[model samples]
Target: MYLEYSSTKKREALKLERGLARVQGPPFHHCYTVSPASQPPMWALRRASVSLTLRSRGFNVGASCVKLAPTCCVEEESGINESREITYGGFLLPKTCFHSGYNSSLNFTVGKRALSSSSTKKEDDLEDGFSELETPASDGNESDNLLTSDAELSDDDGKENVAKEKEKTRRGRVESKLFNEIVNGPGNSVHSALEKWLEEGNELTREEVSLAMLSLRKRKMFGRALQLSEWLESKKEFEFIERDYASRLDLIAKARGLHKAEVYIETIPESCSREVMYRTLLANCVSQNNVKKAEEVFSKMKEFDLPVTVYTCNQLLLLYKRNDKKKIADVLLLMENENIKPSSLTYSILIDTKGQSKDIDGMDQIVDRMKAEGIEPDIKTQAVLARHYISAGLQDKAETLLKEMEGENFKQNRWLCRILLPLYANLGKEDEVGRIWKVCETNPRYEECLSAIEAWGKLNKLDEAEEVFEMMIKKWKLSSKTCSVLLKVYANHKMLMKGKDLIKRMGNSGCRIGPLTWDAIVKLYVQAGEVEKADSVLQKAAQQTQLKPIFSTYLTILEQYAKRGDIHNTEKIFYRMKQAEYPSKPKMYQVLMNAYINAKVPAYGIRDRLRADSVFPNRTLANQLVQVDGFRSNPVSDLLD
Candidate 1:
């Protein structure tokens, strides 16, 4: 046989004695198994190989050209035979072994000739309005960190590294598929999205749900986030951890309201009471600045004999700091009484708290105590120290600490610059502010840009603020917040035309026009005495689905109407804000009530409505009024009683 002769000749030529087995099949079909005794030469590793001559009787050529399986697929009357084979270096393979349909199977590598694997991924993750891969699971995990030196990788090492890359790629594809199927579905509630999908035998794993929840929470889709959390709870699949309940409650409070979240919490079974839900509640209370409610919550925890961690105490400390900051001492005293040792977090908040006041000696003593307790301060601690130093008029000390932080490889960021820029701007040291701003411009983060804009805007340096805006646009696409800030700057400079054009540009660029943008535009119209234009903005905002204005925009209109003695429009705007679910504050109602009183237009109706709503007149509403009206004096200070 030609096969026998060829096998014998190959063994003789390469000195590789391989055992060859021949099987009987159709005359045209030849199957042979060759077991190599040793590694073959690189030239012998061929795949999808055949030994039959091109002149075989079973084969036919079209257009007088050879149409082998490698060159073309043979369409037969029987089941279509697709190529399911690969060719190594001139190696022979049986015809029937891989004469089936196509499948992406494994391919072994020869020396230096690496084959690329082709895999497909979904478009949902990469499409517009979604880039879930921007926050890839292994993003910023550099392979260089895992390497010891610039040494050449061995065969095994190369394969392993390739495997890891492929694994990450495959994981991204899976997550994209899962997200498109579940998260982006038309189901309003989490139950409708995932429950049916699982019941239909589709894979909806616990880890996948957890990842989806994290992404939703990060994206601030708290309504969908709450739904996912509730769905996860209903499934009773994974054991809910402390953070699970805490995060779910937090989302409920954020997406819905505190009362609704509290109602949801009360439904938690008594058996699931081990984790501290009170801690999350304290954090929310702190954000709300409800001193009385926070105190009551803490006291109730004491009455309930609930165990308090250092984190819980830290939340109470931040809450106290926002209110009567002097009460921060009471938090420390409470910690001491309860034998709760201060963590790094405790000291971090304390350092910031102490820094806010002219307590240089107090800060020194706290640092001494931290050292005494064997706690090395972190970057935040150092940053807080710099804040305290600058506040205490110790500029040199602040600069020296900044250098020390840099030496420690604490990367220069917006937080450090924000603390320094304001101090320099306050001291009228525009040079120092410029120098620090230059450093921040190199980073060009959104928050740091706001800080830079604030510095330039406060100085009334129109040219410099515009320069920063231009730089922000060049470095990255302008965000909604950036556009709003630019509009404010334009307003300050009396460049209303440019601001209007910028709003148009934002809309054209598919950016959501937020409440802030409308607020700025309305203020511009109000300043120009274009009352009808301002009203048009309000009407357009009410109708817009994407750019639906928040309560603040409506408040601006109400305040304007109040200033103009238009009680009818004031009441209508107030009602609209309430109907649109814009989270009405008592301050909003109080101002409108005062407007009614000033206009002498049945003030008792508004007053009685306020009383029935339990709206206690706010004292700090004048600050917002000052911002909008550009007033140096509190016009509505007489609104209280």
Candidate 2:
């Protein structure tokens, strides 16, 4: 009983050590060892034994180490060692219950034999006697050749076991880590976690890891997801697990901003089920804008007894329509042969697809198909069709759709408003646009308000734009982008005081003003010849964007200072430019040179300034500066003259 408790404690300690080893990596001894039998065998035995016991108890202690150990004796023997036999005898738990049913077996051997130069080398060396067999080899046959069969068999077994063990470890780690992360959060980098899994010496399986990564991507935590996916592709590890590999490649392709996903579905392993391979291939085809491949995958999926989902089929139709509506008709014919019933989404996809391809006639067929399917096209669907009509410049058709929608008891669906309002505004139906804006005020979605405000802005209806802007601020709480849009609208109308007020209101509302605000202020001041104020705004803008003021703006400020004969301010702006590493433009050089000339600076400084500005011959202002009269008396004279 004491022995049993000691064994349990020892097993627990070894488990803790093995877990530590997996996290930190194989120990220093593992790397420097000449042979597994020679390296700190005591530590390996304890750890391996503990892992064995824990695995026996179903605790998921990995099997790779134990599986790797036998491979040490798996090497091909030298020519002189034909008579030798290698015996590996160790405790491997039975496939049954613990202490009650357990019984020990001795003198076991793996089906391969190689030499071990230990003092106790024979089978009889065991405390319990076990018999051994010897076989004769022809004298001319080398010992190495005689041992070849054993070596080959052991090597094959070792590889398979090692691969299986490593796969288990990787799968265990991935499942546990993902479960923990989902329960908690992205506590550790998923890519780093995957890297650790990859390091387990397992045959790489892309599908399992890709699915894991795709889940992470959906949560917007794409950073590590992208890294692992790229690593998998570069290593060609993607071929082993090709099932969902294509689907994950789709995401990676999108994330990378590629025009198409660059994966060959045929490279996927035959071991993967048809459904996984089909979906993944279809997904990749769709992501890459290759509807032809998608259709091919769809057709081939049938052979695998894998039915393409309505979602995938819809995507294929879209791809066809986007690339060519003539292909869309072909897709419909294929779907009809397959007896796949089109859903509202399927119909919507057809309409949207035709709209994108400018296939108005094709869109009419889709409308007819929707009626045939007993699916009444909703306003949202109508709105999509309206957009198609709008794109075709068929305002009459678009207005008809909108008029039909208005005649219905429109329940203020923000989605419908977003689609319909733009069409109305584009059609010069300002009254209809205004009515939508009023509806948006009562059922205010952030998206609806922005769309309404933008549509009003397009119509140059400043009062209506301002009304919605103010209402958006009060209702949804102003975001910086929203406020910036309002500021831009005010600036567009040359409402300087109102723009200024909006800037102040932005601060009062606790909305951040970005570089846009500063640029707007500086531009207004420069246009108004309030260069002093413009320079002040420019200074603030520079601090915000961490960018040096451009030479043109600085030159304008310097021109104003030079006109007022404020040499101190002009020098300050010049030095500020140098400190900020602002590149001196030809216009800037001309402005500064003229400033020095007009300020009555010495002839030497005036000539040097002209030389500096004259570097660019096409810069007319530099030539004009030196020729203009009383440049020494008034910098303004150069401008006025």
Model 2: per-residue Cα lDDT over 1-641, one tens digit each: 00022445445644644454443223221222243333332233223222222222233423233322221100011112122111111101112111211112011121221112111111111111000101112233111111111101110101112222333456342342432233233443544555555566644444555455644443333344656666666767645344245445445544443333334345556664545545554554544444334444554554454543444444554453333222333334334323445556555654554454444654565565456445676554666677668767998988988889676656633445655666788777899897876776765655566567767876789888888888866655555546555665665566778777777876786654444455455555655556778787777767775433333445557777777756678778877865764433334444555566577664245445544532322224435455543335566766888
lDDT (tens digit, per residue) of candidate 1 on 1-641: 00112344333522321111132111112242332212121111111011111211123222222222211000000001110011011111111111111211111111122222111111001111101110111112221111111111111101112222334456352333444444546645557777677877887676777666654543445677777777777778777865577677778776676677677778665664523565566556554445445555554454455655555555555554333332343344334334456655455554554455444544554554455455666554665687568767888887777667556432333345654565556455688778778776655554466667767876777778778887877665556657777777676666778878988888887665656667677777776677668878868876874334644556667777887768888888888866765433455665575565557554534434644543432333322233334223454764642
* lDDT, candidate 2, at 138: 21
TM of each candidate vs. truth: 0.51, 0.37
Off by over 4 Å in 1: 1-203, 233-243, 326-329, 343-378, 381-405, 408-478, 491-495, 515-641
Residue-pair clashes, model 1? 9
How does residue 342 of candidate 1 score in lDDT?
64
Lowest-sum lDDT 10-residue window in model 2: 70-79
Identify the candidate with maximal TM-score: 1
Q: What is the Å distance of residue 221 in model 2 from its true position?
A: 5.5
